[model samples]
Target: NFATLPIVAIIGLTIATMGALTSLPMFWPLPTALLSASVAAGGLALINSIGQMAGFLSPYLVGWIKDQTGSTTLALYALAALTIVGSLVALRVSRSSAVKVAGPA
Candidate 1:
């Protein structure tokens, strides 16, 4: 499955931090790879922007979850669940014809 490694990495995050960190890079090129050459740059830009936004907001979200729950455990679990959902979406995208590379013109 396309999401297999990422799902594994997410689970590893709750265990060995370094192992998860190393595996996380394995999917970094996925967004650009899914785009056709004609739209690669713009697609990558949008993807990067979204990623940056998530990175900026994720800590605040986790902190808020922690405040509401009085423990970081639930926050971490929520983050992990969200990450798994993201991976599944990526897998679906990878399978969809919309992202297939165009034939030579």
Candidate 2:
């Protein structure tokens, strides 16, 4: 299922639009829009890449822990801890990095 195109598209679209991204036209205020779009794109890519890496690594980490300690609970706890950390980081980021664009609105 890793090579599923529709699933990948859905995930990509969700990540991209999760930040309220939009295509910018090439014109006057369009320049500002383009800049905003680029920033959004970069942020989305960074977040998605990190998320994907974590998703890919988690199972491997769990397997390794299970192999060594013969217990999956520790790995699960580690995953939960990571999730909490990520959530806290996201909350701080959302509060600190609010972007404002002034053109007509």
Candidate 3:
């Protein structure tokens, strides 16, 4: 994920910059333009900072799981299978539950 950091940063910056630039025509006053830009930049920074922190923590978690299991491949395969089964079960549960709420809609 560290390798993907630069790409993510660039994407975040582009999104924030474009958002502020696009809002320039709508906001009117110069103060509003500056505030819009500041808001966009702040939001982007918050989101990307959280993502970056998660990226760093994920490796440590994977390492801990691998240490417990002795094999990262096996751990990953086990997790994948469990995830598939969980998703299927969740889908069924959701479908059944939704049936109870499906009234006249």
Against the reference, the lDDT scores of all candidates come to 0.75, 0.63, 0.57
Worst lDDT window (10 residues) for model 1? 1-10
lDDT of 1 at 10: 72
Model 1's alpha-carbon lDDT is: 0.75
lDDT of 1 by residue, 15-102 (tens): 6567557656766677667777788888878878998999999999989987898877788788778877987887887678446555
Worst 10 residues of 3 by lDDT: 26-35
TM-score of 2: 0.60
Q: Runs in model 2 with CA error above 4 Å?
A: 1-35, 103-105
The best-first sequence of candidates by lDDT reads 1, 2, 3
Best by lDDT: 1
Model 1: number of clashes? 0
For 12-98, candidate 3 gives per-residue lDDT tens digits of 768857975675454333222233454656745664696588658766766888899776766555555754674576456534533
Candidate 3 is scored at a TM of: 0.34
Off by over 4 Å in 1: 1-25, 98-105
In model 3, the runs with Cα more than 4 Å from the true position are 1-38, 74-105
Clashing pairs in 1: none
